[model samples]
Target chain A: MSIPNDRKYLSTHEWHKAEGNVVTIGITQFAADELTDVTYVQLPRVGATLQAGGSFGEIESVKTASDLNCGVSGTVVAVNEALTNDPGLVNRDPFGQGWMIKVQVSDLNELNALLAPADYLKNAGH
Target chain B: MLKHTPFYDFHVSADARMVDYSGWEMPLMYRSVVDEHQQTRNSGSIFDVSHMGRLHFSGSDTRRFLNLVLTRPVDDMVVGQSRYALVCNESGGVLDDIIVSRDNKHYLMVCNAGNREKLIQYFTAFRREHDLDFDLADQTESTGMVALQGPKVIERLASVLPVDVKSIKRYHFETAKIMLIKLSVFRSGYTGEDGIEIILPAMMAGMAMKMLAGKMDKENATLKPAGLAARDTLRLEAGMPLYGHELDENIDPISAGLKWAVNLDSNFVGVQKLREIAAQGPKRVLVGLELEDRRIARQGTTLATSDGAPVGQVTSGTFSPTLQKSIAMAFVDADHSAIGTQLSADLKGSPSQARIVKLPFYKRSNP
Candidate 1:
């Protein structure tokens, strides 16, 4: 459940690990912890252009359904195919294996404005 | 902030995933909902239902008090038998749906968890207004409940309980001292299964659970601890309606498809309003609907006709585990509530294909 210092986090509980032009997006461990057991996931389509803060997908937990928002502006490169079969990976390891999507960043400058791990933990009220 | 129950500690120790459910911090599930739900369907499942309310009535004519307070008959109740009833306001609007069991000296009223406080206060004022010679006690806080539910539950629990589990008829209950504390064992539950709900004294609840758990382990029984998450799905598959969602302070029992529980024979506060509604028929009736796709219609989502005209609203909805498709219950116009009627459920932003199904989406294989 530890968030790496290298990644930038969104206030909406998503983490963005940027490596040059490609960025990996996933809901935070805190988000997955709050969601409990994930049942079904409606993932975003690959090769689709999604602006920052847009809904990339939706996830249903045992109790309720929640929206997965885009952490940074990008065009969808790839999505976690395993999530379609076993959505519970979101609960197992949200930071690594449960990454929702791979996006080609539309705005490289936008990543600089995102919250750091310390600020993310503060904003999340943890 | 979520309100914690008296059994919050017990839930946490059992590794329950806690969640804020309508202001109550309750166990979502101890394990998985699917497993727990199947355990209930296949074997037995225990539930921590300590948050539910128990209102006691002890007076010479407590039977008459029930006749006055509920829409069900008090005179017809057999000893040790439980009957479902609707506690109504003056306008035939349902205040709450409850189960009342007639004990020799008192009547035990089990109300919904969310409506416990409001119902107790309502009865207090009603008892005062009519001079109903009965005492009302909200024993929800001090009482912890554990339900052994499913087909094999009675047989499994029989090893620990002294009573002949097979002899206890459905909906009948009795009081006994299980281990050390006084206990009330009711052969009743929400799930469509042969089971019993064990009510133990608040202090000795842990003892009761430990004994049950020990028995389960010794027998190598397929028993799992269920929670509110599995409880909801089980109730839904069994065609049970949850209060606040399906029935509110405004909905009448007649419209909720609970006429069998309503006793129109004797007069109650809402008898006239009920009679008027019965005579004219209700505008909307609750019905179970099955969707073709896996997309669920959430609560408060609007129901529409094929032409997109709004008809009613979804009261409860979810992807049914057993059915393997989306299933929901909605209050539709009485004309449309008929079985096999086609209706469009507005799934999020669009209408989804659905049809009115039978009351119980899952038909049990009765012995």
Candidate 2:
């Protein structure tokens, strides 16, 4: 499992890649590996607002169901519709095409509090 | 510490995701759950199911003891026949569902691992009460079990075994030797497929798997290592009732749609209560639920009417890999258990459209 250095991670396991004021958000590869064979994903509406450290969605795997939390507060700019048709993408490419949502950043300062790759790996017990 | 099966090392070497199940550290998957599920349906797959309890009974009083203990009639069973039966409480509640196979010299009973100790205690008490002279042996720890399941299972088994795999009838078991290792092969499985479950000495399990791998490699047949996820989905598709999910102390065979296994004519432990249940139907009945869309209705989800009055509870639910739809088994009020009756599943507070479908959302083409 590759943990991209460019992306910041939350202790809850969600990852955020900042690009200017927009942030590409998804669950970390570590999270996907733990869940295994994701069968369903219920994402928030594209226009809905999110709260930092709040549950933004729900994911269901073969044997488990869990909440997906948001790392930072923002407006949901886009939601991955592909997951509805093929949820296995979350298992296959958690960091790439499996990206869950895109948030228009309301506070760029929030990224400073997120964990770096090294910190995340240690905290996640990788 | 969790118990480890003989295949524990093999699973770890293969990087399988392991989880604690019924006090056993068993592999949840080697590759991905969906991959294994599809492979088992289309090809062949091996499963390490050594956690299941195996008991051997022998002596002059074996048949009488079994007939009195189990809900099935065992008096007419031939040497090579096996019957699916339920061990019920005096009140007709299911203790465990078991498979009793009659060998030439003794009888073999396979019970669920989670209920092993409880069933053993129950049987021991019964034996003392009846003063029977039968010897009961626990073969679970001494033996290892692996199931080769799917459409292509017989061909894969034939590649390694000397006997004709197609000749053994379903529910029948035969002792065979492959590469000088004795295996008690049963032509049965929980999956809705033609498969065989092999039981051997624990020490020889790894060797047997290696031999199976070699045969499959030679034949170029489809065989993969499957896990508990696939096993569960496969059994659900087959409409087979799992013990904890569909059968329990609170649920009886009649309510769980296992009436065929309960022979009321025989005076068993639960005969009186079963007779009472037969005279007056159970208040709640098990029914199959098919979600109209892809949204999964998980277990413990409430089943409600279209207008939103709660009617029942979902026992087991999953995204049916075979049907490519969401399906579940729920215990609903008898009044709402009719086929095609419109219903809805309360999924995280949202009422998802569902309907009562026939039991077994998917059935094997051949079966």
Per model, kept true contacts as a fraction are 0.12, 0.56
- Candidate of highest DockQ: 2
- Report clash pairs, candidate 2: none
What would the per-residue lDDT of candidate 2 be over residues B292-330, giving only the tens digit for each residue? 877777778998887878999988888888888888999
lDDT (10s digit) by residue, model 1, range A1-126:
357898999888889988889999898888887776676778778988888878988887756788888767778889999987677799888888998899999788888888999999989897
Candidate 1 ranges with C-alpha deviation above 4 Å: A3-8, A17-22, A80-86, A92-99, A106-126, B1-6, B19-25, B215-221
The Cα RMSD across the true interface for model 1 is 2.4
Model 1 pairs whose backbones collide: none
Q: Rate the local accuracy (lDDT) of all candidates.
A: 0.82, 0.87
lDDT of 1 at B254: 92
